[model samples]
Target chain A: MNIFAPVGRAFFTLLAQIGRLTMFLVEVVSSCFRPPIYWYHIGQQMMRIGYFSLPVVGLTAFFTGGALALQIYLGGNRYGAEAIVPQIVVLGITRELGPVIAGLMVAGRVAAAIAAEIGTMRVTEQIDALTTLATNPIKYLVVPRLIAAVVTMPILVAIGDSIGVMGGYIVSTQSLGFSSGIYLKNTLDFMKNEDVISGLYKAAAFGFIIALMGCYNGFNSKGGAQGVGAATTNAVVTASILILAANYFLTSILFAK
Target chain B: MTTPKIELRGVKKRFGPKVVLDGIDLVINPGESLVVIGGSGTGKSVTIKCVLGILRPDEGKIFVDGEEVTHINGRARDKVLRKFGMLFQGAALFDSLTVWENVAFGLIQGRGMGRRQARDIAVEKLAKVGLGSEVINLSPSELSGGMQKRVGLARAIAADPDIIFFDEPTTGLDPIMADIINDLIVDTVKDVGATTLSITHDMASARKIADRIAMLYKGKIIWHGPVSEIDNSGNPYVDQFIHGRAEGPIKMEVRG
Candidate 1:
């Protein structure tokens, strides 16, 4: 009983955290439909969460695409199948690596940023000040970030998908002795619209997870500087983990056939 | 008799096992300033938070202008909040915004006023607090502590709210600046004709701004009276606190 007690407590704590996150999500989503959408704030957040994240997301995708092509070429050489590198690279980048890498990178960059900013506001009584000013903090802060993330993530993933395929193309043509026209033809012929759409859907879900985790941790942050730092760490960690987990589930459901 | 501007009846609040407010019953009349004075961690801030709906009381009833508002939510809560303004202890001005924008935030964001009109009103409010046009475009971080408090005061009064709250209005300023802030609070409250509730341990700030004083000790109101009567309130806790005496019925918890 004594040993089970710790397990029971930990289980309940996890349940409590899940419950809190769910409620926070419901509130933010509901606020989206209400009046006072704060179009200005949504635009600002889109610039921050989407535009500012482009360089990092693009660079990561490019590198991952190059590495994936290299790995597939080397692995396929043993089977005399190196000619399939372009096809494999395009399929993998568009379907998996592009959205996942972009999500992870943005989760590290944007989630930590959102958490630190909102957590500082929380500790310094700015959030309470918002309340007294007849403003809802969730509506004022969280909804805009959520909306911007949901809207811009698909765009980012789309761009990253193109850049990633370009990365594989460059590697295959310049280093692997494959002709540019043939590699391009293979990639174009192998890629499907459903693959791209599925990845975009995954990007949107990851964006929601990133913003939601950031805002939830930030809103619940307490103490002072240390509390905010902890919130930032927690936000990135939770978002990254959730993105991977959600990817697996989404992939299973979307590609069940 | 006129209905009290604000009233708390058996308002109790606790955090976990630690009770911060122990069944407080208080009233603030219309157009009067009431200051609650106590040492740190005496639940003075919590009392104000309860009234503001920033922190809900565990057990209580709170009323504003004779309307019960303890458990209201959503639009009703925002409707109630429209009548209030607050100056936080840290003078929590939004550091991201320019000084005038900080002052105009509640106006532009809460009431949806046009930006140009809100900026004009913000500048006027700043001038009322003795801030000139030169400081309008600067960020809150660029201002001195006293200037920040002035900007905070300007923001608090910008909406012309019916009730204003001052949380440690003179916490970090030098004696001269504290006095200046006190004078500003007095002038602004009078100008707006708003009932005010303030909490502080600064006796000078209390004496200068409060029409009436309440002494909170151990989460309860130990003594309350008009400012004229605070010095002679006769309760040992009140006597010890107001006079700044270390040795009396009050005991300081020196853990070290």
Candidate 2:
């Protein structure tokens, strides 16, 4: 075998995958602009992706916020900066932990579900059936999920942010012996609207990543049960990785001095 | 002379190093049922898919209603597809949708019919396939294999399409259910006055439903004749296939 054959093959395979994904993204974006928007389907997806995902996202954010407070308290104690817990906790939860944690959680929940559902549809020819029935599968399947995730993720994250902040406040005042009024005052004083807004922006981007990865994997899935299962796992893993990667770039862009 | 309802001229398709269809040419006259019979992996499905525009042929032309449809896409493809209906091997019903909704899906989604009116038409079509009103509201997942095939047939004829394609319609069913489905397909095609192109390995299904039969071997139509003449076609491949013989001119690919 040629020394460079394997490398060349791998490189071309990567390029081909990128090309296919770009085309898929273009189709999805183009379809979104077209008419016959299925508002009913969109609403249903919002319920599935946004509403049903709430408790998990909320619970994750709550625990994260509480743990963050405890950690900050312990670490700050070494420097006689224990009182900084409220400000740091609020800032961390709003600006980073809240959106990222909720995103990962929903990536695990919603992205896997979307991939499994659509992948099964593909293997079973229901997607083809949709095409034969005159319904564009992208319009009926991908667009609704895409629109719902983009619209609802920020809302979900915003709610999660609130719950997270509340968790921090409760843990600090109740267990850390911090005064409730002082903690609230410090949290509000330390946090800028931009911090919260940036997180919401990240939430929206993460939502798009999750839905795109899921739909892309699912639509391209072949074979049968094994294919669907692989698609589901791939969707969650790829979406979670993309969320984190996008978060870094978004953070730099949004918060650069 | 009127043009054949659907015609394939020297169509060819390949997947990587493997060639699924080398060169295929066939025709189905208006309102006639043509069954393309072949063993597994003979590109029978590929032939139907090429004509349906699901898979594009690398060479040659496909004409539906005398119009060249080889390279059509977008809205033009949809317009071409509107004249066609298909029942896939596994019924392919939407598990999310109820039986009636599956039947009326094309009407509502494709033709812009209101749900209520589409539902009414769906019920009527379902009844034609001997399904009662009670089954209409049930999900396809709730139905038996035979019942799902009936629903599939109902959905196929729901739009009264100009052409219909059946891809192994009797697959995964008991022999009795298979015969029942074959009878229903014959009756429904007659009711709609639709041309049909079906592909199956089952000789019984081919005999019962085909007006004209074509045998696809190695991606080429090796034999084509009227159903009555299939018995005396004198093609060893056809004889071996119909008789389900393991030892014949057509060798089965098996490993010890």
Candidate 3:
């Protein structure tokens, strides 16, 4: 037996998967431009992916912000720079933690749900039923989810950013004994509009990744219950990883100057 | 001669090392019901899927109304598909939609009809399937298997399609319910005057609804004839299959 045979097979399998995903992505994008946009489905998905996700994303960002404040205070006290806590906290929350945390959290919540739903449809032959009815599955399923996620993530991230800053403010003013006005002033003065905007940009990319991964995994799922379970798990894991990976690249590009 | 409603010639499909359909050839005349009977994993479903363009054949040609459809795509494929309707083995109703919505789905989504108009027609179709107006608003999951099959039948015939495909129309129901469904299928198909191609291993269903019966074994049609001729086709395979005998030329692949 050739030792390289298994390695070559795995490589080819990976390549084939990449090719399939690329094709799926192209189909989804093109379908977005076609007629019968299904605005009702898009609105429903927005409510599910965005509106319902508000509390989770907000809570996550708030806690993250509070923790960052505490950490900054501890680390800054050693350098006698504890007064810089508010400045750094706002910057961190708006520029990095807010979008990334919300993205990852939403990926875990929404991507898994989308995958399981679509994967079940696939296994049950409902997707085939949709096809037989002359409804393009991508247009009916993927495009709505994609549009909802892209349109909603930035808004979700923006809200998350505000909640996160408020969290930092609460922690600093109440626990750290900083004046509320001073804390707010530092937060506002230190944070550039560009920082918040860049985070929203990352959020948009992350949203696309989350919906794309979910739809792709779900659409391709086979077997039965086990397959749907795998699709759900794969959607979350892949979306989370892609969000973080994209965050780094997006950050570098946006903040390069 | 009138053109066959749907025709498959030299159709072949395989997954990896396993060949599922080995050059299948068949024809269904308009308004005739052709049942392709086969055991599980015998490519009966694949054959139907190939004709529906859900699964493309590895090799061969498919014609619908004498128009070549094997390689059609996009709007053209949709146009071809609009001529057909299907009832999946498990009913395959959308849990998200109510029974009436499920029936009207092809009308509203595919044909772009107004929702109220589609719903009205959906209700009318449900009534034809012997479902009351009450069940129209209920979700599919709330219905029993037999009811779901009725709803599926309603959906299949809702659009008044030119050709309908039934994939194991009676697989998961009681014998009485199965017979009921079979009768309903015959009545509905007659009402619409639609050609049909059904795949099932159920002899009872095949006998009741099929004008012609085709037996698929080991990836090919072994025998096909009028339902009246199925019992005496003189093919041992068909005899053994219809009789449900374990000992025959067709051996079961049982392993301990």
Candidate 4:
């Protein structure tokens, strides 16, 4: 009977995990304001999490945009609504695909890196060393990373949104035999600032979520390399799920009608 | 005659069915160097972690300087932690930071000291550990195991803390390097007059550095006494561990 209770326990565990995430956010915010700001460490964190993450985010968006263009143009000819292809590609790439796909890729890359790096530090006592020096690890390690993700993810997303939209345009005009002038006009006419803004907001939130999940799992990691591996895997999976869920919530709020 | 700097009472920790740190009780006098000796995975590290609040024990209490530290928080916890300096099992210096930066990590980040002042102190601390200023700009990865330990030692004494912890400080170093580290430990502790607790599997390192020694077995301190009495501690577990014998009352937990 006890062995069969995993299903029930899992549900409660999920509830508990969400609670922990909320607690983590609050704890981090509270600690952020306290003394002992580690600016240099923050810069180092920005380098690791933000600057190093551009390549993966860029590639994911470009490919996704290119694929979207091909799919939309192919489907449009069935109803002779070929003019709608450009508009659809722009709207889809900017609003949904860009942020979501970029997020998933960065989440996989950044979250796992943060987790493994911090998890190793946790076991090796670097985190403890900070404490003994009277330096707060939450400030030195977690806060800088959280701040970096919050700031960088939006930038990555903005670039991703443009690149993704361009990817679709390239495929439509060059590969799929569409007139460049007409395709560009349709894309411009249908796109709005609100759509891009919403995507950036989502990207920022997703970045925070990625760093948060990674640092939380990493800081709490135990048992050495095996613990680091588990944290990395968990960060990717959890960040992906959370991004999707947050996307739904953001969309509903942004377009209530 | 000095007060006990670290005191643990009935400290017990367990992970699911696995019991670790079963009712560990000990007291370390101020300015004394104490070594905890045991085979690998015998809860020596767990005992130290319990004292540091890294892992909370399922039962028991820990106190530092007559103040209960196991459950304190906020500025109080921060204040308590300021008294400690630890050299991790590995040096654990930040790969992201230079050697001087790693050594000055606490002074600059924790205490909010100015960069120039912290750097000066970091340089001085490095010199104390026999590392020249030339080594300061290099990252920790550039250093060998022995040099890294020296950097770790520099970081530990950088803040001149009241207590210092060394976790397997000499495990990976060669015998000569191990002796050098022990000598550094002795000299540094003498210079700072800080209480020290270390966990090690190496008897020669323990013998060279410890003023007192304790042997951990089956999750408790099986024997504790002045360093001079370790050979005659009259505990077979201590005997087997220090002597490095294959057969004893202790059995390995091998799956084979």
Candidate 5:
């Protein structure tokens, strides 16, 4: 037997998981046509993954937008052009920081919670109980979170983008010596609708990643309390990394011009 | 008198070098209660997991209603699952849902009943488990352990399943509450006339609920007999386990 066989097998297993995730998307898409949706479960997940996420996303966006304005104004001031702060800050927040930061914030908050909650259920055999009750564990447990993530993410990003732009406007008009109307007009003039749309699309993808990582680690969790803690940690770490990586790929394509 | 609800033959499961179940054989006759008893980590839970298809065995055959069900998946596995109910070890009521909602989950999700109809059944089952309608709207976490177990029991029988699996049904209950739950199990199963395969190290529960008892040791069933014949099983392993002795043929592994 080859000495490197274990390493090769581990790589193959990762590939297999990715392949299965692809198949799972197909399954979820098909199920969208099926009637009798688990509305209650979906609503519950929305409260967990979406509504509770607002504070973290909002605070992060506000601070990030403020910091961006300060940094840009300081850098551009050397050339006697600190006036472009609003335009740059709005574009930076809407096109990049808003979605990416929101994604990372959600990864830290929601993903770890999902992993811990579901991992506890898995270790306690609640998932098995769902199966025994003739409820498909994936459809019942996973699909709700996925649907909530997909549906709520765009909304969160939209909110974050608006709030972040406002944050930049606050700093620009007050601390940076730009008129409110001029700052607003500059942001509108410089950025197109494509930036906002692109950000929302990335948010949706990040939501899927957050939910997927949470469910995967939770579902495959082993041992008990220690295992659940580990799964929660892994879910957050993996989700944050993937969100950053996916953000880079999305940005490249969206900003290719 | 009727066909067996579950049958296992030469069932074995192993993880790396550790074997959990080894060459097991069992039959659970329809409408009868069969309890598997053993010390901690003796594969009682593993046996139930194998039957539920949560954990697949390394080798064996499992039959439900005389049909081979070991290797099935997707729709086939679901079809098999519809015949069963389970009460988990820790009262696995979804913390997110209300007590009534958890009980009605299978009815609404699996059977596609309207919320009104499912909630109606949920209330009725909860009443049967001695939980009032006032408690129905409350989250499961709000309830006490015995009450959570009651809710779990209520959920298990909510679908009126043809078969039921209860894992450590009374692990954390007081003797009176344990007896109450045991009695409820007996009453509800009789009302539905469901086949049950329960696993518990609790002899009082086994004696109260099981028509027959099987003792597991070192991943195999070393002794099995009618509950009426348990004390006289003449098997040292069974004696060591059921009586909670630390000596005899079975040695308690020293934890690191």
Candidate 6:
């Protein structure tokens, strides 16, 4: 009986946390549709969450695309089917590597930043002051980030797809003895619009998850510097996990026959 | 006979199993300066938070100008909040914004005023707080502690609110600086003619700024009176608190 008590408490705590997160999500989504949307803040966040993320997202996708091409070529060598490298690289980069890598990287960068910034505001009484000053913290703080991430994520993923395919093209034409024109042709011909569109859809969902987790953890952070540190760590960890989990579910749903 | 500017009726609040504000009833007339004094963790801050709608009371009602405002939120609460300005304990200036921008935040974000007009008003308010335009472009972090508090004071009064709150307005400054801040607060509240509520453990500040003083103890307003009558209140708790003594009915909670 005594042993079961701790388990029961832990279960209840998890349920409470889920309930709180769900409420926060509903509040943020509702606030997004309300009037007085801060266009300036949205533009600022887009620059931060999307434009600034390009370098890191592009670099990660490029390296991953090159590595995927190498691995696929080697695997195809065993079966005497190395001719399939360009086609597979194009398919894999468009469908999986671009969205997933970009999502995870942006989650690490943007989510951590949002959490740290908002967490500092929370501990310092700025949030309460906002309330007193007739400003809604959710509308002023959370909604802009949510809107920017949702609107800019697909653009980021699209650019990542192009850069990733180019990475595979460079690797294939330069290192794998494949001709540039034929490899480009194979890459272009093998890619379908559905693959790219599906990844973009996944990217949009990942963006929402990243912003939601970041804002939620930051809003609820207590104490001081230590509390903010915990919130930042939690934002990154939760955003990454949710992106992967959401990716799996989205893949099954989007691709199911 | 006129309705009280602010009223808290049997308001109560608690967190988890630890009760912070058990029950409180307080009032301030229009254009009056009321200060709440209590030792650390006696719920002085929570009382102001309850009225400002920053924290919802678990029970009872709050009224501003004779209208019930308890439990109101969203735009309705924002409407009520329009009447308020507050100087926080640590100033709480937005570090991301320059000094003028921090002061102008309420005007621009709340009233939808243009940036240029707001900046002019911010400059004007900063002048009232004894800060010059030289500090306008610098971040809050660049200013000294006393200067930050002044900027915070400027921000608070920027909108010309009908009510103002001062939360420990002189916590971390030198004695001379604290006196200067107290004088600024007195002058600004007078100029704005706003009903003022201040909470502090600084007895000197309370004495200087309060027309009426209330002492909170164990989550209740145990004693309250005009500032002149505070010395003759005949309450042992008030006596111990004002003289800054540890030996009295109020025992320090020493946790091992």
- Find the candidate with the highest DockQ and give its number: 3
Q: After best superposition, candidate 1 residue A205: deviation in angstroms?
A: 0.2
Which stretches of model 1 miss by more than 4 angstroms? B253-256
Better of 2 and 5 by lDDT: 2
Interface C-alpha RMSD after superposing true interface residues, each candidate, one decimal: 0.7, 0.9, 0.5, 1.5, 1.2, 0.7
Task: State the TM-score for model 3.
Answer: 0.98
After superposing all C-alphas onto the true structure, candidate 1 shows an RMSD in angstroms of 1.4
In candidate 1, which residue pairs get closer than 3 Å at backbone N, Cα or C atoms, i.e. clash? none
User: Cα deviation in Å at residue B35, candidate 6?
Assistant: 0.7
- Tens digit per residue, CA lDDT, model 6, A1-257: 59999999999999999999999988998999997799999999999999999999999989988998899889999989998988898788778889999999999999999999999999999999888878999999999999999989999999999999889888988899999989988888888999999999999999999999999999999989999999999999999999999999999999998
| lDDT per residue as tens, model 2, A160-184 | 9999999988899999999999999
Candidate 1 on B58-174: residue-level lDDT in tens?
998999999999999899999899899999999888888999999999998888899999999999999999999999999999999999999999999999999999999999899
- Candidate 2: TM of chain A? 0.98
* Model 5, span A65-148: residue lDDT tens: 989999999999899778889788978988899999999999999999999988999987788878877777777778889889
Instruction: Rank candidates by DockQ, best first.
Output: 3, 6, 1, 2, 5, 4
Q: In model 3, how large is the Cα lDDT of residue A41?
A: 98
lDDT of 6 by residue, B1-256 (tens): 9999999999999998878898899999999999999999999999999999888899989999998999888778888999999999999999989999999999999988999999999999999999998999999999999999999999999999999999999999999999999999999999999999999999999999999999999999999999999999999999999999989999978761
User: Comparing 2 and 5 by TM-score, which wins?
Assistant: 2
Model 3 spans with C-alpha error above 4 angstroms: A1-3, B254-256
TM-score for chain B in model 4: 0.97
| Residue B110 lDDT (model 5) | 77
DockQ: which is higher, 4 or 6? Answer: 6
For candidate 5, the per-residue lDDT at B133 reads: 88
Q: Assess candidate 3 and give its lDDT.
A: 0.94
| Cα RMSD (angstroms) for every candidate in the order listed | 1.4, 1.4, 1.2, 2.7, 3.1, 1.2
Question: Candidate 4 on B1-256: residue-level lDDT in tens?
Answer: 6668899999999987999888999999887899999988899888887888777888998989878888877788878888888998888888878999999888877677898999999999999999998999999999999999999999999889999999998998888999999999999999999999999999999998899999898899989999999888788888888899999998988752
Model 6 fnat?
A: 0.88
Docking class of 4: medium
